[model samples]
Target: MEDQFFELMCEKSSSESANTSGRTEEFLDSSANTVDISENEEERDKMTNFLQVIESYTDQEFRRNFRLNSSTARMLIDRYNTSSFYTNKEHGGLPKVGASKEIYILLSYMANTNTFREIANLFNMSKSSAWRILRRVVEWLLSIGHEYIQWPSASKVQDNMRKFKAMKNIPNFVGCIDCSHINIKAPVSNKHAYFKRKQFYSPQLQVVVDADKMFIDVFAGEPGSLHDSRILRRSSIYEKATDDVESKFPFNSFLLGDTAYGNSQGLISAFRENGFLTPA
Candidate 1:
């Protein structure tokens, strides 16, 4: 543009050059002004190109990705704008931080780490908005997950254990007890406290699963601070003295656990009570 302006100025001033020095001053001013104009025009062209790229997104593709049906999208957004936490009995209307409806829908598919950004891109929502919705849905799920997911009783556990007898050297089992871990972010302070003896940063989960590996009953959620031994001692399953209770189980059935569990009354594991689990 500067070059073009200079060329035009030169062409216009060529005839004037024969007149006087005043013409040179005027021409220089005109050339300088022309350069600014050309620069502004170039900038405008660049802006136009940028805007074109932004606008190039196909409406069809966008609508599909964003789940952007006008009525549904507006309703969901409005619900988020007005609605509060589903778990909060006290606080009525809208989740405290992340309860946007669009995000909640995304979480229904979040069996894995599939990201909020991907969801946002698909849903045509802001990443932050998608993230908030996901969070709230998770909280909501957690809040009610327990009531729906229940702990089975002793007889149920006993009945399932009989099938394991089919496996050689396995018998009289009610359930298998073990520890699982829940993933979490490291806290800023006392990092070691959350860390398990396994040297991992996860919450320890104590579960009692039947022979088929279906969860019979569980100790539920607990921090990693305690050891497997202490966790069992404190668990309601342990306190119930399930093994000692006289039940109608054939041979007064029992359960199994790792060597981590020492001998307890009626609770049978090869680690603690050998012959109870040994094959017929």
Candidate 2:
């Protein structure tokens, strides 16, 4: 009888040990699942907050931050959506960013000097993703730039001339030409060529604007160390004007430029004062 009791106790202890092991495994699994769910909720909340912050901005604030009004931003988003480049995935990988968000990211990059990492964090994306979106958006805008920026038609030139005459009492004035310096990092080749008088490395952008301050022509990629006259001579507009002034300056109109541009067939500059001019 004592031997039978000892065997029964051993069996009972074995059963209890197996049950405890099973309960421990179940608890560990439940804890792991809880951690996963918590992480997912946190990510969702972050996205929600990011979107809400943007949506709550006023019109002025939106323009200040994005460099464009909300309506114009929406229009760009719609336009981007119509292109083949607009997609939510690449071969069924992680979902791609939407058009609206991509545009905002591009504009933010343009309107500020924020680093890619900062921009990515603000938009809830990775640095590489921000770079990719910028490349796509910039290429799209460049592809369509010619449609918006071009020499005025003959009639349009005449209209612009009239506006210039009325505004500044200058006859046959069609547009204003000027140069601006854009800061850039030192290039690996010919670093000195990009260093300007302002003690920084940069590139120069030459633009022609009509009376309405709308860009009619843009020429860039010249080193900042170069003079305005040299940049102008290197431009296609100069080549065309020098070849056939009538082709570019219809109605005998001319562009007003600063002294840096000197004088040309289709351009006029202010006379330098030497402090020896007699009253005429």
Candidate 3:
């Protein structure tokens, strides 16, 4: 499981180039001169349908949260051009799912502990399809979103003082990495060999994220049985550092990890030995 998780992490691209124009302020003002009203309305309805599929969130609830209405939804959907619903076919990319995106629908329902069967019933998809879509969306977010996260520069560090909670002389920390687990169904009878104890428990990454909930360095992807330290040892980020001749924070830079990570010159753990606490 540790090896597989590491493999997935390695699948993460190192590319940083992302089209910011499609997502930010420029989107806000794209509505005014955008002539075609029907096209815009179709896009809006897709988003609204998308929103409706996310269980437990009603139209009233969405309006309350976003401070917008049915009318505003049109502008928003137009601005949020990621959906293919209203795109002119001559433009590019695959077509929209016609109904709300199955991916969106699955994620919306995933916020809680809805069974695969229940989710499938609600979305009119097979349980396997629902699960597959959930995994793909997660991969997309981890791939694109993780790369686009720029570290807070020294110039912005002062402005971000609020994200920090000073400890000793150290300021806001990026993270104190940890791992957690979720319940999962056991494998089928003949596939028992493929199931590990951790396979019955899905891992969740926990990082003491900064203001943006972005990881400074410490991150999680270990199996339930693997120590956080061992996870770090096998991580591609660590591999890149240890193997790179020009890496900035070589093995000399300090990091904080779980008690399982222990203490090293370059890695700090809040350790307590024989009832005596060790100072950082």
Candidate 4:
């Protein structure tokens, strides 16, 4: 009887050891699975947060924040994805951020005066990433700008002229030309050259717009101190007008300008009052 009791105790001890071993293995497997699941959830949450921030804004809010409509923003993203610069295999780095998100970053930077650090925090990216996106998007946009902004075709010019006539009874008026100042930081060199009458440093942006208020031509980068007429004379439109006025101003079309620009061929300026003018 004593021998049988000892044998039974040994069997119980062995069974307990096996059961402990099995439990240890199961615990390790469960811990490893939990870790993997936790990591996946963390990553997924980051992406979801980014998307939620963007989608939470209404259409009007999106435009107000980004300075572009959602549809236009989507179109830009579609174009960016198909561009060769975005698709080149030679460039290597960590996996790229999505074009849609990068575009939002770029537009945010452009639409606001926020620094890279601020923009990065807003978009959940590094400052370096925000700067890189801005530079790349700007370069791509510059490459394609001419395709979208150009001198109107003859038919389009005629349509613009009719629209202008109907709107303000201005005969053969195709566009209105004006110059506005774009504020800029004072340059290290020639700081005074950019100083404008508004008590700030800036560069000039001269533009011509049709009756629909769409830009047909743009000239920029002149010093703010220069007069509007001087800037116009330095523009390509002036050069073209000087060479062959008929080619650009076909059908006797002309641009309307302010008193500052004065009267010239292919352009008409408003009369400046000197206290000696009749109503007619």
lDDT of 4 by residue, 1-280 (tens): 1011001001112333243234323322333333222212222112326656776889888878876677777777898989865643433565557778777877776677666556666766655556657656655655555554567788998999899889988789889999988666565556598798889876677778777776667666667899999999987778777787888899999899999997887899988899988977
Candidate 1 clashing pairs, residues 3+ apart or interchain: 65-122, 66-123, 66-124, 83-93, 83-94, 84-93, 84-94, 84-95, 174-254
Candidate 3: TM-score? Answer: 0.53
Pick by TM-score: which candidate is best?
A: 2
Per-residue CA lDDT of candidate 3, range 5-95, in tens?
Answer: 1122212234421222122112212221232222222221112333454435566774454333434344323433464322333313534
Candidate 2: misplaced stretches above 4 Å?
A: 1-48, 90-92, 276-280
Worst 10 residues of 4 by lDDT: 2-11
Which stretches of candidate 3 lie above 4 Å from their native place? 1-100, 125-132, 148-174, 187-200, 203-208, 216-222, 240-253, 278-280
Top candidate when judged by lDDT against the true structure: 2
Candidate achieving higher TM-score, 1 or 2: 2
Rank list by TM-score: 2, 4, 3, 1
Ranking by lDDT: 2, 4, 1, 3
Pairwise lDDT winner, candidates 2 and 4: 2
Candidate 4 lands at a TM-score of: 0.78
lDDT, each prediction: 0.46, 0.68, 0.40, 0.67
Model 4 clash tally? 0
